[model samples]
Target: MEHFALAKEFPPASEADWRAIVDKALKGAPFRVLENQLYEGFATSPLYTGAATSPARHGQRGWLIVQPVAGASLADAERQLADDLANGATALSLDLNNGPAIRKAAELKAVAGAGVPVFLAPGSSPADAALLLAKADKTIVGTAGFDPLTVFAMSGEVPADRKAALADTVDAALAIRERFPLVTPFLASSRAWNGAGGSAVDELALTLAAAVAYWRALEAAGLSREDASRAIGFKLCASADLFLTIASFRAIRLLWARAHEAAGIASNEHILLYAKMPPRILSAYDPQVNMLRATASVFGAAIGGATAIEVYPFDEAATEPTPLSRRIARNTGLVLQSEAWLSAVADPAAGSAYVETLTEKLAASAWALFREVEAKGGLLKALESGFVAERLRQTAEKRERAIAHRKERITGVSVFPNLNEKIALEEPAAIIMEEAHPTVDFALPAPGAGERFAALISAAARGVPLAELHSASRIVCDIIAGGALDVARRDAEPFEVLRQRADFALASIGSRPPVFLALLGSPSDYRARSLWVQSFFAAGGIEAVLPEEGFTDVEKLAAAFKQSPAPIACLCSSNSAYGELKGAAAALKRAGASHVYLAGPASLLASLDPNDQTAVDRLIYEGCNALAVLEEAQRILRVEELAEAAGLEAEDENFGAFDEA
Candidate 1:
């Protein structure tokens, strides 16, 4: 299991206390006494002192929260934009969906408000670009235009006059730059790398290299290095890995600062960092799980230092997210800001050893990769030569292998206890293409590498190995190709179902403590008793996953054993009953679980027998020895790292700002 430490300085004596804090804090309650809002205050202390800075403070204005529109109706998009603007969204991502939508949104002058920037995502049409500019300021626009090689790959019948099709993207970009001085519209879109399964580091390195192409292309067109540097921005992925996300963004800006110096560009101004939600973590089943994913992504984005974050709606795992999902998507940023209080500070990761070490490692790795891309004649050439794509293909394959082996656990879809709840998606789906008017003048041909990708992989069609057959005309790197069938070979053996254990173990040790405490009481008493049990668990670890109905009966006991400690146990029950079930508890004691509590009258402790074990250890009373209990749980976790954690203390702060460390 990946190990984690709860920032040794923030450490409580036991896992229960640590977890209790997490639960209390995450409940959106006030825990500002210990950590700063958005994790900022305690950053300077020794334990958290070395933590790296969070993205929240990277820019004085804070990261922009954006949402994109693809193939959605202009009216719908305009409405969405209006809603986002009203709901605290930092920016707009217009589709041009087409010319009419562009025209329609541009005409809604009051909606955009003065100076609220709009960024056109990659692959945007010039006409749509013109429309966004007309409506509001769009100085730093983003694009997914095919890089020269991609253009080359897609270049089937372009006339020699339009050979400029490749060169003209820059020429057009320059013209727009002169007209819109603040605007930096070029290649920072995910149309290539992400659509093709690239790694986070690869994404950063390749995107930087591609930007180098625009610089070289513009330099050839008589634009100086300064202007070229001004034209490119970066859009990257923010998945569930918090440090990885932060490192990727840090690497980009750090590289950009260096590359600008190499290219003779003045000022470290204008390297836009655009981060987007990753589709890889999304699951089609019980789509609501996506909300959790997007939340983590946004949190990662905030920590990673994204200048702007585009939250993919929860339903984006398969279909276009509807209005409701989109609203949730936009509101996620708000929730993080208002409810979660994420935007109140900057560089929230600062002073953590793990985040700091990881940042340096990632930056170093990405830097080396960037140099390699440059060695291969820059990103465009790297793409054309299949080097970048092939390298990323390997990383993606490795990740796929890990998932198959069960090294990576995807909740709900993978390892866990079973559930039989029927999930019928009652929500409506959004239109695929309402305003997808990409405005490139000359028509481009097929994928320079002619292969198609799928929208989603169904359940039954998983586990089949990929077919490697390819035609000469295809961009056929077998390593980079998808499996022939939908079924994916698992990283581990398929899970087998079994009946749950009979005896339940009640363990509680962290905020209240994390012992898989069993509340073997009637439904009425379940809630009341479980409260103390949960408090006992939280005083020890992460938040508890309470049973839905919160009851522990015969069926419940069996179900609990699948996850909880084993052997049947009870809380607040009589000694006679406790002694009657000692055999079951004894058997459970032999297996794994071995505790039962009375929570009954104090007189019972004195009356219990030797086998009934009137021993002080057996009939311990609550509120009597809180300190000893706390000490014991700490010893337990000190040896175990809570199963899955970053395992380092305060790794984020070591950067020393501008590489002082």
Candidate 2:
């Protein structure tokens, strides 16, 4: 058998050759149009000719399939744990925030004795670390989830005795390490930053800064540099942007290696990176699309060499996760690894020019920002000084503007919405409770942070109820309004609000707010815009009444508009046809249309008569603020006020009208 070299048969193509072809296609458009400017302050080109040099490698073969388990009771958690491990999951993340109370060591014997690594997310309480350490299986391994910095960032509060609380957290982490040698006691996570709408660069810098703070604190408490490094693990969010997500995971590893070098560690020791799917891109409408988003996120994380990955259920945004949703989420990783063989190679994106370049850019930008945070005294100081919050605010505002203008399209929510799809969510099961355990008051007077942690652990060993222990050990921190970051915002929230308003109107008024599409000229002239207009209105839950065919006569169009229930009308046609319908807008206004819109560019206004142009309220075209236009149409139809008058609480009040950009 002869293997032929294909490259020799084809003539070599240079960057110049590609440029010439692209230039011809672009015509007179600037070459810059082919470049994409990211919010990270860098630009990516359309082509790369060669592979990057010396890319970072994860030095591993496969990622752990981590499934999140949350339940209303211990039995529920146990059932989910067994089901997940039996099906496909190799690891478990126990969400203690909403899980059943564990009062005794035997209660968690099932979880710890399951023989798989367990990640304990103890929520905002540092005392929960003591609970886990008391009851955990001695061989249990993974993160203990003692992250004070992230908790502070999310809740905007610090202990009244901040210094003591910090010291106590370090002490608890050290104790955990002594007991469960393989378990990382402290977690340096980017959840707060990522959830608050920070960019990838922001997440990296903030997480690095927090890790650095923890490393120093652990060292101060008498751990060696290497031991301190080993005691901490990282958790980062993997978004749907494949290339960027891959770069982000790779970049964090590089950044951490640099940190190790700075600390005089001889070798770049392994770091545990736990990647999670972010909720920012999930949509409440057409939720099945979330499965696709989750697949992309899991693929990116695996390719970029994550140690573990967790995929959120597809219906998580709309309602509670059903058994089917959980099964699908778990299998998403299983199929990718087992069938796709994505984990068969290490550093799969190593030589790709685009990914490598992006990785470098992200690392450099994040390092610079990390240094900025360090110069401000640290992550905490930056937060207190409002530097971090302000930066996040700017990025969030920019993102919201892009989303409103349709520059950042959210499929199924802001575009291509299906209003008629019936979503039948399964009702959550009623939680069955066991007999209550008698509460024990294990109060200690004026103990130091270390002593308090020890007492909590001892109490847990004695089978004191978790609720009682939590109440006894609760730490009240001062609330800092100026330093608090906003809550996690979903990209589809604004449009979902409009849909809710329309639903309210339909229930109260026997119809959805309608928009009359007064298409001009023949079907060939207005067909495209008519469909576009209908879909656009459907996104905002408005029913667009499109004509079967276009009308060249203004009088006929106005008569149709008057006969319809729509209070708003939009003229849809070709630019030349729009020019031909000189009195269309004026006629619609005269026919009792409260507002009239033109479906072409504002440049067409020059061709219309002065009276016709003056009668037009707005222009509906690509790149316009669709949210604002929809809200205006809703206002013209009085959707909100009418619902209110019918004794319905208008949900749109929570989301104010989007400012037109």
**Alpha-carbon runs more than 4 Å astray in model 1:** 1-61, 70-72, 96-115, 125-165, 417-661
Best by TM-score: 2
Q: How high is the CA lDDT of each candidate model? A: 0.49, 0.80
Q: What does candidate 1's lDDT look like per residue over 1-661, in tens digits?
A: 2676567566346656666867676687654544422111112211233324433325523678786643345576557666767777777665443222333333535434434556765655333444444444444444423244333322222223333444435544655666556666675544355545556666666677777766777677767777667777766778766656776666677677777777666656456777777665665444677788788888877766677787778766545567899889888877776777776666666656656655655566667888998898665455556675567567666555455434455554433422332233333433343323333222223321111111001100221111110111123121212221111222211221000000000111111113444444445655555564444333222123354453334344435644542222334333444333333332324334434434444676545545434322333234434224433443342313222223323222321110111
Summing lDDT over every window of 10 consecutive residues in candidate 2, give the lowest-scoring window.
652-661
lDDT of 1 at 388: 59
Could you tell me how far off, in angstroms, the CA of residue 34 lies in candidate 2 after the best superposition?
1.2
Q: Give me the runs in candidate 2 sitting further than 4 Å from their true place.
A: 1-4, 52-56, 100-106, 122-124, 424-440, 444-452, 481-483, 642-661
TM-score of model 2 vs. true structure: 0.93
What lDDT tens digits, residue by residue, belong to model 2 across residues 36-122? 888787889998757556644677668889988666577877898789999989998875555565555558777777777888772
Q: Model 1, residue 295: what's the lDDT? A: 82
